[model samples]
Each structure stands twice: as structure tokens, then as C-alpha cells.
Target: MQKFPAVLSVALLLAGCAMSSTQFDATREALRGSPPLRQQAIADCTANQARRSLQARQDAARVMNVSVRAMPRTICTRLVAGWSSGRLSYDDYRSAMVGSMTPNTVRIIQGR
Candidate 1:
């Protein structure tokens, strides 16, 4: 009875070590098998999408008498988030900028 706790503790420690080693080997094999070219392609696609989103927001701001440089963080965040999610249409984007602007604000940027 006195040795039971010590035996159980040793068993548990060995099991934990074995599990960790299995996980490490699996991780190493997965990394070795993955194609780095595929990872680079995915990264490039993500960056291109981000650039398109930013351009859309700037275009919207120009049409609405809104200053793109002076835009609130919330507006930019919403633009990117909504655009990426497809929650906001091109028309919706145009409407939001126009709707949010003050009536007296003259549109400095032409061609809405």
C-alpha cells in the first residue's frame, strides 16, 4: 500500500513523456511534408485582397465628400470587415459614405 502512490506517479510521468514525444514527431513530419510554395501563394492572395479592400474604402470616401486620410478608424475597420465578409455590396458601400456625410459638406473629389 505504501508503494502504490509512488508506482502510479512514475507510470503517469512515463505516459506523459511518451505522449509529448509522439506529438513532437507528428509535428516534425507534417512540417517536412508541407509545400512552402503553397504557403507563399496563400500569403500573396491574402495581401492582394487587403489592398483591394483599402482601395474600395478610399474610393467610397472620395465620392461622399469624406476625406480618406481623415477617416475614423471605425469606418476603415468596417469597410475591410464588411467587404471581406461580402456583407456590404458595392452599392451599399457607396450609400454608406453618402448617408454618413453632412449635407453641407461639398464633395471635393469628383465623379461619384
Candidate 2:
């Protein structure tokens, strides 16, 4: 029949559209499942938070002329590294930095 080609073309067009939509959705879901950019974004956010906290402690210590105890482990190792590098005394460092070690800081030091 003369109508057969028209029907076939229309069906093919519809099928192509369906396939395109499915592909787009699949791509989106795949990206959502394990997005590297999002993972990196979270990591960056965590690092920035740690940096700000450490800075806040340093600033506070400067104002008080005494470092506070119980810093996050990440901050503590950084502080300890500073001490080991001759930036601070072992005794004074211990006094200034006790209880400041957070688990996250420890993890950071351990290369986690």
C-alpha cells in the first residue's frame, strides 16, 4: 500500500526519539551513580573546612597567647609537624596541642 512507507517512517522516527531519550536518561543516571566531580567537590569542601578550623584555632591561640586543647587530628598532625620542624618547643607544643588531635586529623596524617 502507498501508506506503508509513511507508517514505517513515522514508526522509525518515534523509535529513534525513544532511543535518544533512553540514552540521555541512562547517561544521567550513570553520572549520578558515581560522579567524580561531585566526589571531588565533597573532598574539597572537607579540606576547606579543616583549613578554616585550623586557622580559627591559630587565630584564637594568637589572641589568647595560648593554644587550645582538643583540635581535630588533621590539625594536630599539622601542628605537630610544625613543632618537629622547629617551629615550636616539644614541651610548649605538647601543652598547647594536647587533646587537639581529632580522628580525621589522624586519618589525614596516615594518608587516608
Q: Which stretches of candidate 2 lie over 4 Å from their true place?
A: 1-71, 97-112
> Tens digit of lDDT per residue, candidate 1, span 19-112?
3434534433443355563243334433432344455546544444456543333233333333333443334323323333222111211211
lDDT of 2 by residue, 2-109 (tens): 111111122112122323434534433443465573344334433432444455645433432444332333333333333233332333322223324334333333
Give the Å shift of residue 28 in candidate 2. Answer: 52
Query: What CA root-mean-square deviation does each model show from the true structure?
Result: 25.0, 26.7
Model 2 lDDT at residue 104: 36
Can you list the residue pairs that collide in candidate 2?
A: 70-99, 70-100, 71-100, 72-102, 73-102, 73-105, 74-105
Candidate 2 at 101: error in angstroms? 14
Q: Of the candidates shown, which would achieve the greatest TM-score relative to the real structure? A: 1
